[model samples]
Target: MLVLTRKTNEAITIGEDIEITILSIHGDQVKIGINAPKKIDIHRKEVFIAIKEENHEAVKTVSLDSLKNFIRKS
Candidate 1:
């Protein structure tokens, strides 16, 4: 992992479009702001993981339904 230290109001840029900045720091909690094009997606790690798992479950349900339909037709 690439780690860097940034103080309040400091920012780091990614590629040509994304920029992440430190907005504030209160004890252990840090607030950040991100600037990016609307086409880009940004999600918290937990939220992203939940979405991935939901998609996987949906695919499994679809496959099971397909198999059942195939068996019924046979």
Candidate 2:
């Protein structure tokens, strides 16, 4: 992993369009802002992990064909 040090108001660009900036700091907590194309999505690590886990569990409980069948009935 590439570790970087940035202070408030500092920003780092990714590839071309994505930019991540340090917006504020309070104690040990830091607020960040991201600028990216509408096609790109950004998620916090914990939230992403949680969503992945949930999706895994959901897939185990239901199949794509079953979901399509339900959607057709609706």
Q: What is the C-alpha lDDT of each candidate?
A: 0.95, 0.95
User: Which clashing pairs does model 1 show?
Assistant: none
lDDT of 2 at 27: 98
Candidate 2 residue lDDT tens string, 24-74: 999999999999999986888999999999999988999889999999999
Name the weakest run of 10 consecutive residues (lDDT summed) in model 1. Answer: 58-67
Off by over 4 Å in 1: 64-74
- Residue-level lDDT tens digits of model 1 in 1-74: 88999999999999999999999999999999999999888999999999999999888778777889999999
Q: In model 1, how large is the Cα lDDT of residue 29? A: 99
Tell me the deviation in Å of residue 63 in model 2.
4.9
lDDT of 2 at 26: 98
Q: In candidate 2, which residue ranges exceed 4 Å CA deviation?
A: 63-74
